[model samples]
Structures are given as C-alpha cells and as structure tokens.
Target: MAELLVAGGGIGGLAVALAAAGRGYRVTVLERRDAFTELGAGIQLAPNAFRALDRLGVGEQVRERAVFIDELRLMDGTTDEVINTMSLGTAYRERFGNPYAVVHRTDLYQPLLDACRRTPGVELCTGAAVTGYEQDADRVTAVLANGERVGGDALVGADGIHSAVRAQMIRDGEPLVSGHTIYRSVIPMDRVPEHLRSNAVTLWAGPGWHFVHYPISGGREFNLAVTKDDGAREAVTGRPTPADHVLAQFPEIGPKAGLLLRLGEQWKSWVLCDRDPVPGWTDGRVVLTGDAAHPMLQYAAQGACMALEGAVHLGSVLDCDAGDLPQRLIDHNYALAPRTARAQQVARAMGREVYHPAGVAAKERNAEIGSLSQAELHGKVAWLHHGTP
Candidate 1:
C-alpha cells in the first residue's frame, strides 16, 4: 500500500483519511491545531453528502446526530408572506436515493475523527503545521513547521479555504471576499417557541438580505444563518453582536423570526469568501480537495457535498490504479474538477439571486420561490441534491 500524507484535519481531510484507510492504504494526517476541533456552525448534509457518508461507514451515526426535515419553507421577510414550499423528505429520497438532514459541525466531525483514530492504517499527528513541500519525480516530501520532513508516496491537500497546499499551487491568488457577511448563531430547541420550532429548513428572502433557520440534532436546537450584502457599510467594528442587534438592522423580518434572532446567544459574524475555479488541482502525486480546490459561496449548501464527492472520486481513482499513482492522480483531478467548477458557478449565481435582488424583483422572486411546487423545487436543485454526477 502506498503511504499518503493528508494536510489539515478539517472535514475534507478527515473524510479523505478515513476513505483511504478503509481501502487499506497507510495514511498520516498532519493537523495544525493542538487537538481535533470543529469551528463554524450547522451543516446540511444533502442526499449526495449522505451517500458519501454511507460509503465511509458512518451514515447511521450521522443520521442519529441530525434532524430530518420534510420541507423547505420560503417566506417574505418584509410582508410575512409564504412564498414557496418544497417537499424535502420524500422528494430528496426519490431524487437522490437518500434523506436530507442538518447536523452540528462538531457532531459531523467527531465520528469521522473517531473512525480515523480507530483505523488500523491511519496515523494522526496534531500540532504539525505544514510549511512547504518538495517533490521529485518519485515522491513528495512535506516540511513541517518544526523542521521535520516526512516523505509520502502522495499528498492530499484536504486543508480548508486558506490551504497551504493551494497557496503553493496558485501562489499568486487568495480567497476573494464575496462582499457578503453572515451573522450566525445557535439556540437550544427548548429556548425556541413551540410553533417556530417546525421540523423544516425555513428561509426568509428580502431585498439585499436573507434569513434561514432549521432544527438540528433531531430537533434539539435550531441553527440560524442570516446573510446580507455588505454594500456601503463600514467595517464590522466589534465582536458578534447579539441577535437583537441583527433584528434591529432589519426590522422588516417576520415577528417570529425577529424575536427568535433576539433570543439567540453567542452570535458571530463571518465574511464570506470564495475563489474562481482553476483548471487543475494535481501536480504529480499531490492534489487539492474541498475549499482548497473550490471555495464556494454558501448559498448552494453544496460546499461539504463537493468535498465528500471529491474524497470518494479521489479514493476510487487511487484504488483503481495503484500501480500508476501519478496518472491516477491526474485522472482523479480531471474527473473531479468539472463537477466542482459547475457547483462553484452555481453557488455564486445563487448568491447573486438570493443576496442582491433589485427593488420589486425581491418580492416577486420570493413569491415565485414560495409558490414553487415540490417537484419544481426538486428539479431546480437536481444537480446538487441528486447524486447524478
């Protein structure tokens, strides 16, 4: 079995490590943090994502930690009108052959990390920051911050949006701020009012901003994500303001949503960033995955899905041609790049529509989305929610 080195122990890195180890390869993952930690908020595992998890042998565990929803509710924040509703429970199962669920980021991370730790062929080393790498025709040598050098038959850059590997590839580029900032928070399920705690992924769209909320952990709590275009606003001055601060920014939201926002604690702000897709991700035996390869806008919710797909495709390619590892890496990049590029474009377009609609167009768009039949909504996201690729 070829020895592989994976950088960054985030979701993508951990998934790749588990997938590769399950295939009987010797794998070592170097994570910069002191321990395994998951930052960020809720993650929606669409059907395609679930399929990937199933393949990695943690599907049931993921389901147990997530909330299953039947529909996606769309509303107008300004007028408090129901714009559209899409059936997710049956529609997702029929379209993608799996269920749609929302999971806490930590809940998703722990299972994958635990699997990797228990795997026979996997070695995880924390506090080892990768400084650089040197590759000859035969192998790649990763340089650690502590001046230690580790050799591997191949390297997988499963690092995150600010990947060190990606920096080495496209040395001239950086993640471009998408001019949108999201205010995120999570509240315990019991804290939310009974009626507002529907088992649905609810979204309220308005001019220049949108609010989304959904139950996670089997309805144990709600994850709220509110986004707005950062137009002419000044730099964010202080720490994440309370939910009341968010509601005050836009008093136009529905009373229930605004009330919920005011009640949320530990509010935080994240400036969205993305990069244009590149044509290639492989240089000899080293390759990029997830946000490193395609940093996408959050509108499509396919960022994690794309990472999962990349892990599966990369593992399949390597397993298929263990003898020709370099060629296999190239083929793997080719197979994965187009799908990621398409998803990146779609995510950016969705961001434009959802975050910057003009004048009356916002209300019309909201109404149209709200009125969408379950079938139409399913068809619209078939490329993403369905495992067609």
Candidate 2:
C-alpha cells in the first residue's frame, strides 16, 4: 500500500483520506490545530457535492443533518420584485440525481472526520502543520513547523487557500482580495417572521451589493450572508460588525429584505478573496487539492463542491499501482484545470455582472432571468450539478 500524506485535516483533507483509505491506500492527515473542528456558520451542498460525499461514504450522515430547500429564488433588492425562481422539486432532483441542501459547516466536517477515524488505513495527526515538502525520486518528506519530518510516497496539499505547501510548489503569493465584504449571521428560525421563513435559498440582487439567506441546521436556524463591493484592500475573517454598520452598506435594500436583515444579530464579516486559476498544480510526487488548488468567490457557491469532487477524482486515479503515480497526478491536474477554471471564471462574472448591477443593468438581468423556464433553469445548472464521476 502507498503511504499518502494529506496536509490540513479540514473537510477536503479528511475527505481525501476517506476516499484513499477505502481504495486501499494508507493515508496520514496532518492538521495544524490542536483540535480538528470546523468553524464556519453554514454551507450549501449541491447534488455534485452529495455525489462526491456518497462516494467517500458520508452522504447520508450529512443528509440527516441538512435542510433540503425547495427552491432558489432571486429578487430585485430595490424594487422588491421576484426576479426568478428555480424549483428544486422532483424534476430537479431526478435530473441531478440528488437534492440541494444546506447544513452547518460542522455537519459536513464531522461526518468526513468520523469516517476517516473509522477507516483502517487512515491516521489523523494534530499539532502537525505541514510547512513545506521535499521530494526525491522515490519519496517526499513534509517538513513540519515543529522541526520534524514525515516521509510518504506522495503528498496531497488539501491545506486551504493559505496553504504553505502551495506557497512552495506554485509560489503564487497571496490570494486576490475580491473588494467585496460579506456580513454573516445565523438566527433561530422560530424568531424569523413566519412569512419570511421559507424553505428557499433566496438571493437579493442590488446595485453594488447582494444578500443571500437560507435554512440551515435542519431548518432550526437561518443563515444570512450579505455582501457589498466596497473595494476593500486588506483581507479580514470573522470580524465583528455592528448591525447598524451592516445596514448602512445597502441603502437600496427592499422593505422585506430589510426586515429580515434587521433581525440578524451577532454579525461577523469577511472580506472575500480568491486567486486566478493556474494552468496546473502538480509537481511530481507533490500536488494540491481543494482551495489550495483553486480558490474562488462565494458567488457560485461551488468552492467546497469542487474540492469534494476533486477528492473523489484524485482517489479514483490513485487506485492503481504506484509505479506510474507521477504521470497519473500530472494527468489529474490537467483534466481538472479546465472545469475548475471555468468555475472560477463563472463565479467572478456572477459577482461583477449579475449580483452587483445598477438600475438599468439590474432590470435587464431580471428581465433575462424571468424569461427562463424551469427546464431552462435546470439546463443551465446541469453542467454543475451532474458532474463527471
């Protein structure tokens, strides 16, 4: 069995471990933190994410904790008009092979971590941050922050956007600030106005800003994310912001959306960031996965989905003999670039053109989206939801 080393024990790292162990590869996952825990509020999981999780053996566990929303609605923030609605009913499920759902980030993380612990060939290591890697003809060694070295047949950098492994391999410097800052909150669903509490992932598009809210934590809570294109330079994460400050960012927000936004307390904010996709992320025995490989805007909501899909793809290719592994890694990187890069491009465009349009442009967007039938809506997202493998 090949000794595979995965840097970062987050969802992507644990997922790859689960996938590799199930395929008979001995895997060691090194996490920098003292405890392996996820810290995000909520995450959306498309059918494509479920397809990968089902392959990695954690789909049902996640589904049990998820809130399966019935529709995705787009609204004009200034006019309070429904721009479009895409039903995630039987038709969409039948087309995509799974339902669209949202969950607490922990709900997604814990299942992957539990399965990794239960698997025979997977080892989870804490307080072992991968600083960089050195590879020769036969083996690659990960240099840790504690001044120790761990040897393996190959290394997979599932380490997040600020990955040190990526720093050494790709040397791509820092991530690009999106000039868009998002404020997030989660409030009890029961507290939300009954009329506002719908089983839908709703997005409000305004001039230079947008808002998204959905049911999460098995419908017990609602997750709120509102973003503004304010040309922010520094990268910020989980920074606390007063409710008044957040309210001031979107002057043109509609009355209904304003009511829902006003109810959110304990707000936290993040200045969004991502990198332009590189042509390749493979170097012999060392490679990258997840956000380490491709980080993009949350506009598409496909960042984690792509990571899960990549883990499944990576595990599938590595199920063969180890002698030709380097070539396989090269092939893997090449094949994944086109799809991921397209996603990155699409996500950037959504943020600039669709979500943050002005009066005339916003009306045009609404007119165009309103023209699409449910089947047309399904057709547009089929390429994303029904993925290869």
Candidate 3:
C-alpha cells in the first residue's frame, strides 16, 4: 500500500486521511496537540459539506449530533425588519440532496476522529508537529518539531492558516488580517430566554457590524457570533473580552437584538483572517490543503465545507497504483483552485456588501434582499449549496 503523511489533525486533516485510506493508501496524520481533540464553538454545514462528509463515511454520525436548522434569516439590525430568509425545509433537502445543519465543532470533529481510529492502516499521531518537509523524486518526508523524520509517498499540509508545512512550501508570509473583529459566545440553551431561542440560524445586519445566532450542541447550547468592522490592524484569536465592551460595540442594533446580544457571557474575540488564493499549492510530492491552501472569511459559512471538499477531491484523484504522485497532487490543487477562489471572493464580498452596509446602503441592501422571492433566494444559493463548488 502507498503511504501518505497528513499534517494537522483538525477537521480537514482527519478527513484527508480517511479519504485517502478509503482510496487504499496508508495515511499517518501528524497532529501537534497532545491529544486528538477539536476546539472552537460552532460551525454551519451546508449541503456541500454533507456531500463531502458522506463521501468520507461520517455524514450520518455528524447528522446525529447536528441541529437541522429550519431557515437562515438576514434582518435589519437597527429597524428590526426582516431582510431575507432562506427556508431549509423538505423542499431544500429534496433540491440539494442533503439537509442544512449546524454542529458544534466537536460534534463534527469527533465523528471524523472516530472514523480515522476505526479505519485500518490509518494512524493518528498527537504532539508530532510537522515542522517542514523534504522531497525527492521518489518520496516525501515530514520533518517533525521533535526532530524525528517520517517518510511517505506524499505529504499534505492541512495545518491551518499558520501551517508550518505551508511555510516551507509556499513561503507566503502570514495570513491576511481581515481588519474585522468577531466576538463569540456559546451559552447553554437553558440560560437563553425562550423568546430568543430558535431552531433557525439568524443574522442581524447593522452598519459595519452583524450578529448571528443559532442552536448548536444538539439544541443544548446557543451559539452567538457577532462581528465588528473596527479596523483592528493586528490578528487576534479567541481573546476574552468584557461582555459590556462587546455589547457597546453594536449600539445601532435595535433593543430586541441588543437584548439578545446581552445574553452572551464569557465572550471571546477573533480578528478575522484569510489568505488570497494562489494558482497552485503543489510542491513536487508535497501539497497544501484546507486553510494551508485556501483560507477564507467565515461570512460564507463554507470554510469547513471547502476543506472537506478539497480532501475528498484529492483522495478521489490520487491513484495509489499509478505511481504518479507529483502530477496527481498538482492536478488536485488545479481542479479545486477555481472553486476555492470563488468561495473566498464570495465570502469577502458578503462581508462588505451584505453584512455591514450602513445608512442608505443598508436600506438598499434590505430592499434588495427583502425583494428576493423565495425561489429567487434558493436559486441564488443553488450553485453553492448544490455541492458543485
């Protein structure tokens, strides 16, 4: 069997390993952490994500832990008016071949980790950070933080936006700080007033800011993610903030939305960041995947989905028996580049055009989105949710 080394054991890395193992390659995943675990609060999984998860054999497990949402709502934060909403009902499932759902990061991650553990010839290593990589014409090797070297037929850099493997391969400086600060709070459902709790994913868009809330953790917890275009010059991640400070940032939102924001405690903030998509990520027998290859803003809610897609696509195109690893890796990057770039662009656009417009711009955004008929709304998302991109 062929050997593959995957750096980073987050959602993407684990998926890549499972996908390759299914394709008859022996995969070893090198995770830097002390144990195989997932952090973060919640993630929205579109139908495209399910398609990729199903391909990796964990779709059902994820579904068991996910909250199948009723709809996605965009609202005028200041006026308390509904802008647009997309229904994710039976029609949507039938149209897209999958349900739209939200899951705690662990809900999705655990299933992938479990699948990796169950698969034969798949090894999961913790605390084995891949520092860099070296490749000859015949094979590639992962240089570990501990100074140990592991050789494999090919290498995948799924180590996230700050990937060490990517540093060696692409030499792109650092991830682009999006200049937007996002505050997040995950509170138990019981703490939330019944009026604020909902089965739908709702976003209240204000001037240069937005607030999104949804049920996650199988309805046991509510996830709150609110962003501010505060011109934060440096990149920050998961830094705790005073709840009062967080609430003060979005004064334009109506009282009702303001009340909802106030329910959040233990708030943490992250300065959103992503990278400009490059034409290629392949370096001989080594290549980049997930955030290492293409990281995008969370506005599209497709970051995890794109990572899943890339891993599955790579696995499908890599033939162990062909003895053509380099070209196959290059082709994998090429095939996914256009779609990934488009998604990145869409996410960036959504932040500026849809989520943070103000004054007349906000009014026009409301009128335009509110004017969209349900069919028109579904038609607009069909390209993305239909799973091609």
Score residue 256 of candidate 2 by CA lDDT: 96
Q: Which 10-residue span in candidate 2 carries the lowest summed lDDT?
A: 380-389
Cα deviation of 387, candidate 3, in Å: 1.5
- Evaluated against the true structure, the overall lDDT of model 2 is 0.92
- Candidate 3 clash figure, as a count: 0
True-vs-predicted CA distance for residue 373, candidate 2, Å: 0.6
Per-residue lDDT tens digits for candidate 1, residues 1-389, read 78889998998998999888877789999999999888877888889998898888888888888888887777776666777777877646876799888888888888888888889899999998887788988789888899999999889987888888888977746677777778888888899878777888888776778888888766777898888776523333124766666766675667766776676788888778888988888888789888988889888889988888788777777674445888988888887777789888988887667545757778667766766677788899887776536
lDDT per residue for candidate 3 within 134-219, as digits (tens), equals: 88888889999999999999999999999998888788899999999999999999988987778999999999999999999999
Q: What does candidate 2's lDDT look like per residue over 1-389, in tens digits?
A: 88999999998899889888887899999999999998878898999999999998899999999999899999998888999999999999999999999999999999998888888899999999999999988889999999999998889999999999999998989999989999999999998988888999999999999999998998999999999999999999999999999999988899999998888899999999999999889888988999999998998889889999999999988888877788889888988989999899999999878899997888889889999999999998888889754
Better of 1 and 2 by TM-score: 2
Off by over 4 Å in 3: none
**Between candidates 2 and 3, which one is better according to TM-score?**
2
**Which stretches of candidate 2 lie above 4 Å from their native place?**
none
**Residue 101 alpha-carbon offset, candidate 2, angstroms:** 0.6
State the displacement of the C-alpha of residue 318, model 3, in Å, after optimal TM-score superposition.
1.9
